[model samples]
Target: MSVTRITDVSEPLVAAFANLVPQLSSSATPPTRDEIADFLAQDGVYLFTYSNDDGAILGMLTLATFVIPTGKRAWIEDVVVDEAARGHGAGAALVEAACEYAHEIGAKTIDLTSRPSREAANRLYRRCGFVARETNVYRYGG
Candidate 1:
């Protein structure tokens, strides 16, 4: 399969997430078709899928780009490959597509995070040229 940048929502895309998102998180629910459409309407947001010739989506990732006083920035989020598809370069392809798109949009740098428990993902990140930063990442949720 190959990476495809998605601008609109479809039943297949929604179904793809139904299968893919749960593989990434036990508590997370997949995005609805409307939600996907609304998200794509926002500026500098991208959703990419890796699908085969027969139209099976095997992987997906989201890229968010924005500008601040410093410069353009991009973040890759929710990267996941089918459990059966891992180790076959699908994740790397998704990441590479994100980086290429972010660069085309003028992002100075791209960033993503993976839990240490996700050893395979961390290794994939390193293989894709992402460096680990020696800094704290804090999050607050209400």
Candidate 2:
């Protein structure tokens, strides 16, 4: 598998994203083409896809890096691997690529959150060198 940054919002990309969002969350809606384009145009956001040799997308993740008062922070979000492609290392490849890219861009730290019910995903994150944080994660909106 190879991890590639998505620089454009094409039909295939949008379709794949639509298919993956429901897998990531039951209530979350897939982003529209304009939304994807807007996100791609953002200053410090990157969308990446993990694909097989045949050029089929197997997994995807987004990395958002920004400079806050403290320093630069990188956050990985919306990670999802196609259920059919789960055992072939697509998830790992995506995470590795995101982490490498974040580090290359001078991020002070990388952060991500996984639901406890996703046992396999939690294990994958741990294997990728992420430790469980003791801090509370509060969200203000959906």
> Which candidate gets the maximum TM-score versus the true structure?
1
For candidate 1, what's the RMSD? 0.9
lDDT of 2: 0.92
The TM-score measured for candidate 2 stands at: 0.95
Q: Give Cα distance to truth, residue 31, candidate 2, Å.
A: 1.9
C-alpha RMSD between model 2 and the true structure: 1.1
Name the 10 consecutive residues with the lowest summed lDDT in model 2.
50-59
Provide TM-scores for the models.
0.96, 0.95
lDDT of 2 by residue, 42-133 (tens): 99999999888888787899999999999999999999999999977888899999999999999999999998999999999999999999
Clashing pairs in 2: none
Model 1 regions more than 4 Å off: none
lDDT of 1 at 97: 91
